[model samples]
Target: MHIPDGLLSMPMIIITYAITIMGIVYSLRKLKNFPEDKIPLLGLFAAGVFAAQMVNFPIIGGVSGHLLGATLVAILLGPYAAILVMTAVLIIQTLLFGDGGITAMGANILNMGIVGASLGYATYSKLKDMNEVIAIGFASWLSVVVGATLTAIEIGLSKSLPFMKVLTLMIGYHVIIGIGEAILTLFIIKAVKTKLPEIGGVPA
Candidate 1:
């Protein structure tokens, strides 16, 4: 889902950069207000997310998929912190590993960090009270779908590809990927609740 440079048009790139900058700035302010003791946990979660993204599995038609870990991080560290964490991960991947494009960094951050984490967090928060497992699962799945949809739209708007074709292809493969995300998220949440107990106040 990491768009390479030259994939997005100038206008889309600028728009994404503007939105991403605002999200980063707001998240930094919110981070300053977070409890000091929880700072290390943020690092831990970031590291975990970074590591998880290292392994990409083949999907279909020669495409591949990897864990975004956006929803998972949001579940553990709220949307603001999750944004910061994802930003760091993406920067490292782009600059150090060349996984994502340097020019398209802002767009990637906007799609995965802002859209994925924020919407996923909101979804989980609203549904958790009803059923924790279901909430995490649903949020994890829905977040990926939403991100893919946005990516498709961006590509479509560029006039480089057919709108519905790109949309269908992206969403079709990601639907399976979303199931993996949901399962991984649920397992991790369950593990944290059983072992850490203090993290995220996961219900017993």
Candidate 2:
């Protein structure tokens, strides 16, 4: 979900911005020696996520659902590179298309890019050896839920709605939306495995 300006309290905005900036910086440092061969794949996934997120489905209280694609990117490229790819997509969406707010950009990136990629990667890495498809699907679903939960928390902290009410609604709606995410993630990962067998990180 892409949060708009004026939804979050100023302090929340400031704190999220600080944390997001630090995350971006740290992610950048981690990828300073990133391989050249993977650059095209990075750009490709960023474009895909940017396009997918453009079609937003309204949920409630200014939140929306769309394919995040962060889990797919993380599983393919690794989390640090996935962060940069997602950061690029969110920045372009916020700045060029106004898909998200300038003021709320940090929180948007934090929710979808950082949290989604990091957690999705962790889950997939832990379980892929057991069952690749299940790991991919579960991690993809969990990423969406986690991102929505974090957004709900931010909105609740801003006093935009009752915490429990919004939390329940956000989670409830996103749980279904996350199914779409899981399906798409599994499809893309499998496609990559079939077409680009030389690529690293993907389950064999």
Candidate 3:
């Protein structure tokens, strides 16, 4: 979900920016040991996510939800790299497409990049040994829901909208969109595992 400008209060904006900046710094540090060869794959994932986010469907207020692809990227790359990749995508969208607002960019990155990647990666890693398909599907779905939830909380806390109403509506819409995310993630992961099995060591 992309939050536009003028929706969040000044305090919330500053807080989110502070948190997001810390996350970015930490992720960059982790990338210090990242495989240099994976750079292309990272770029590929970032580009794909950037393109996918182009098609957005409006939700209540100035928010809109779309195929985030954060979970999928997290699965292919590590969580740290996934965060960076999502950061790149979000920054590009904010600067080039204005898909998300400049002032609200921090919140967008916090919700979709940090939360989405970390949650998805944790969910998938825990369940993968049990059932790969289920893990991917559930992780993909959960990422979207959790990110939307965070967005709801941020917006609601800003007092721009009633906390319960926005939370309910955001969760409801994201639940449906998350299914699409799950299916797309499953399809892509499966295809990559079949065709380019060596790409990410994605389990078959």
Candidate 4:
């Protein structure tokens, strides 16, 4: 969920910026030598993430919510790249779309980019010994739900917006919507690994 400007306090905003900076630095280091062949794929994935996020699925009675697609990016490009892509999405939303506030950009990045990427990738790696596909699926699903849940908590904890309802709403919708994330991530990972043969050595 995008926390519009003036919703978060100063301290929270500052902390989020700090986290965003760390994430960006980490991503740049990891992507220092990104392969040229993946350029188109990267663009496609970014565009797909943007488009997918635009389509809100019905969550509550009359309310709907959108996805961050963080797990999808992590599954495809690894966690670091996923963070960078998510940051790009947040920037776009802030500058052009006005969907999220500029002050809360850092918070959004930390929520959707860092937390989502780190959780999804770390979970996948931890579960890798069992089954890659299942690991990815589970990790992707949990990452989105967890990411959104944490973000909602962050908002609720804020002095400016200490509303528990946000936590309930965000976590509620994201839990089910996360299934879509998990499935899509698994399917794409399987498809790419089967056809590409070199990406992450995933077996068809």
Candidate 3 lDDT over 94-163, as tens digits, reads 9988877899999999888888788898999999999999999999999989998988988898875578
Q: What is the lDDT of candidate 3?
A: 0.86
Candidate 3 vs candidate 4, TM-score winner:
3
lDDT of candidate 2 at residue 53, scale 0 to 100: 78
What lDDT score belongs to each candidate, Candidate 1 first?
A: 0.85, 0.87, 0.86, 0.77
Give me the overall lDDT of model 4. Answer: 0.77
Off by over 4 Å in 3: 56-65, 202-204
Give per-model TM-scores: 0.94, 0.92, 0.92, 0.86
| lDDT by residue (tens digit), candidate 1, 39-79 | 89889888988898888777668877788888888888778
Better of 2 and 4 by TM-score: 2
With candidate 4 superimposed using the best TM-score fit, by how many Å does residue 192's alpha carbon deviate from the native? 4.2
Candidate with the larger TM-score of 1 and 4: 1
Please give the range of 10 consecutive residues that has the lowest summed lDDT in model 3.
195-204
Pairs of colliding residues, candidate 4: none
RMSD of 1: 2.3
lDDT of candidate 2 over 108-170, digit per residue (tens):
999999887899999998998999999999999999999999999988998756799999988
Measured with C-alpha atoms, the lDDT of residue 193 in candidate 2 is 83
Model 3: residue 88 alpha-carbon error in angstroms: 0.6
lDDT of 4 by residue, 67-105 (tens): 677766776777777887888888898899997899999
